[model samples]
Target: MSTADDTQKTKDPEYLSTLERGLRVLNAFDADHPELPLSEVATITGLSPAVARRCLHTLLELGYVGKNGRRFILKPKVLEFGSAYLHSMNLEQVATPYLQKLRDQTGDSSSLAVLSGDEILYLVHVSTERKIRLGASVGTRFPVHATSLGRALMAYQPDSVIDAYLDTVELRKFTEHTITAKAELEKRLRKIRQQGHDSAQDELDYGIVSVAVPIFDTNRQVVASVNCSTSTTRVSREKLIEERLPLLQDAAIEIELALKKWPFLANSLRG
Candidate 1:
């Protein structure tokens, strides 16, 4: 039984504090911190140790998490959350064939990603037979300030959202080419909007280059971005711009057309 004070603290009578705390505990685990002790989970989620322990136990019973001696880790069942969203959105299903076609045409890695928080979340990736180290895979996230996919997605966002993002985000420099200045990034985003595409050269990783174009919904709203990533050692920036950019744009257009045909997909488009 929850007390009136507890319910009042949540500010909404319908808000379930236990459920929110449990979800927060789950979110505390990520690629970097995949496993953590109960104390660490409590600290990371800003919950008391007792509260965190209860949440962990509930998640464990639900098969969403597993315990290894003193450490707790996310179980395979946790993927159901992400998979459910993917299935509901149908973005991965719709983008897969187009991404594969882009990969076949460019002989490089092609990916479809959407803006998640302040990062680009890879939803689908089609890799070429040739080994390329772009460090991108489905579920991978990279800062929106440092990737062509991010720029392409951000370019189509409303000016207020873009301005708010640039004003608050701490632009970390991943490489010498990474833009750390908000004004410069704003200018670059504007250019991407004007050109209908964006490019990143050794900004996220050394010797890696990528070009991306925005996918639009039936209402011409930007939904997602499609990108082709290649090793700079194997391809010049000029060559990638001249060749792969067009292919990426075509894939984006194809994805948009496919989304228009599916009412569910058109409704799922962000903004």
Candidate 2:
């Protein structure tokens, strides 16, 4: 059974089904399905038409969602949740300047991401003005096995945790260079752990190269990963490792220091 199916089977009695349905309705909207009709929302959330209608109406009344003729779409107010979390963690504030500096130094895109389930969620992104093959914005998510940021974060995890992830998650191949073999990916992750950084070329997308280093918190635990990404047409993988990887590692160290000084921020992150 899938994770969603497992979650459904383990439903708690105290869980508020109404609120859960509402959040599911909201989550049904994404980059691919940005605007959805009422029926589509019901289908995605596995809720009846009446329940989905109630949730949509509640969200609309609360300014979390908007209606365009017959379809419903998320409003800017929904960003309040993400912004509040970012502010509470001080992630954007602490990581933005360093990411910007890395971008400036490498003339490439720099990003900070945290492992979310089997994917990496981009929390902060600073992009160069020049068009790049791999365009990452804040809130973008990428497969953990196919990106340098994902490898960097996964490299430091406990062996059992990594083994469980490898056992449970399906490795989807996105390109010719994507790692689909579990043993091969495990070996690569081991190398990343040994090297203190990870480099990827044409894994997630063609003509894109990236290098990432894990960022540690005050307790010396890997908290997040920072990466520098550029077009392979402009920068070779060797060049990315020799030049951009050092800049990315330096920024990770700076971010780790900031996290140590801001103990409250670190606590909030743990929470």
Candidate 3:
């Protein structure tokens, strides 16, 4: 198999080596191993403990990692790395204005979310004036089984991917309305695929209804999804479909247009 070095040959060797190792160290930590001692980190990344300590110390100095006793763990400040990518994506930047427009039109909270692993990670969010709206934020993570964004993305993924996700991740019940049965979840995903959208009612959090549509890449593959959420007290299912669905669909199309202009996405399209 071709390695990262074979694929990427850059002129700046020093900068490349530093950036590569730093990312490897960050990749060494995840949900299963949220914290690690220097020796463990070295083992995970195949680095010397002394070298690992230096990298961890550098991350600690930058406020990205914190020393919990003798162990190193990621800090909330590590979100800066994700934020940097989100900020650079002009699609997300331009979509913010359009999302705000959707909020103004429907008086509902709207968000841009992407499927990450088995979860939906919110990237951009806009809130409405309603006091009882959905309380999710830009960096919040929600379960794939219970969120509208997750359903929309799943509707477009290969059946094997969806099956693998359901087989691997535990379907913890978040609310009485949440679907825990894998068979039911598969049934719902089929409906979502047929409709090209999803409406999740209080499955994630009580009193919140989330509606989502898939955002497509230039090849018409699902790249991400956009959602509008409102409290059950504020909007009925019929009203949401009648009023907000059009706006969400329009915003998603605009986001697709904006996505095409991004250098990374453009290159991906070419390749």
Candidate 4:
């Protein structure tokens, strides 16, 4: 490659190494590791003890983290970090019509979610009139191993990215159907990718089932996901396989088109 080619390959220096490390430190905490001592944080983030302390102190000062005795825990104020992305993406605004239409067509609950670290964060949710519904709320977070939307996003990630993420995240089984083994999870995700949708049954919550598909940008990069959820008792697995999957796939195509035309996200749309 020529010098110009090498130059083009170099990453932007102004991205700020310190800021990136600080964010990584924040990501080291989750439901399982919600509170960690300085040493644990250092180990999780691969930062020196002193550096982790400094970073945690800085976060505490910014109201993003709080110290409880020897352990550090995230605070509610940290939600602003996620809220900023939600506001910037305008995901709810873009997905509302599609979710509404899906709910109307299938008479099931629909949701739009995005991956954040090892979890899926719901940005848009539309409820149905079913007496028994899958209770999911906007801004709720669920493990990647358990949720249909999470599996869809994980399935589309590059092999390297998926390996790195699976290496760091613990695979906890939420129910009997949850795939906890790394090899098994990868195999399942590969099937999901090949089939163009993820069908999860009673994985995240008992008696809940869902079908999900990736929502792509103009560049065809998976930017987010959409899922239709119902109670396990109300819908048979065979029906979801033969019916709901097609509906979810169709909605995904419509979402991709809308995402491509969205004024604010035009620059980020893949393909």
lDDT of each: 0.87, 0.88, 0.82, 0.81
Best by TM-score: 1
Arrange candidates by TM-score, descending: 1, 2, 3, 4
On lDDT, the stronger of 1 and 4 is 1
Q: lDDT tens digits, residues 1-271, model 3?
A: 4457545655446456666677789889986899999999999998878878888899889988998899999999978877676766664565788899888888889998778888888878898767663477777788888898888988888888887888888888988999999989999999988888999888987888878999887778787889889888888877887788988999988878887777475343222
- Residue 146 CA error for candidate 1 (Å)? 0.5
Q: What is the overall TM-score of model 2 with all chains considered together?
A: 0.90
- Give the least accurate 10-residue stretch of model 4, judged by summed lDDT: 262-271
Q: Who is ahead in lDDT, 1 or 2?
A: 2
Order of models, best lDDT first? 2, 1, 3, 4
Give the TM-scores of the predictions, in the order they appear.
0.91, 0.90, 0.76, 0.72
| CA lDDT for candidate 2 | 0.88
Off by over 4 Å in 1: 1-13
**Candidate achieving higher TM-score, 1 or 4:** 1
Between candidates 3 and 4, name the one with more favorable TM-score: 3
Off by over 4 Å in 2: 1-14, 267-271
Q: Which ten-residue region of model 2 has the weakest summed lDDT?
A: 262-271
Candidate 1, pairs of clashing residues: none
TM-score of 4: 0.72
The per-candidate count of clashes, in order, stands at 0, 0, 0, 4
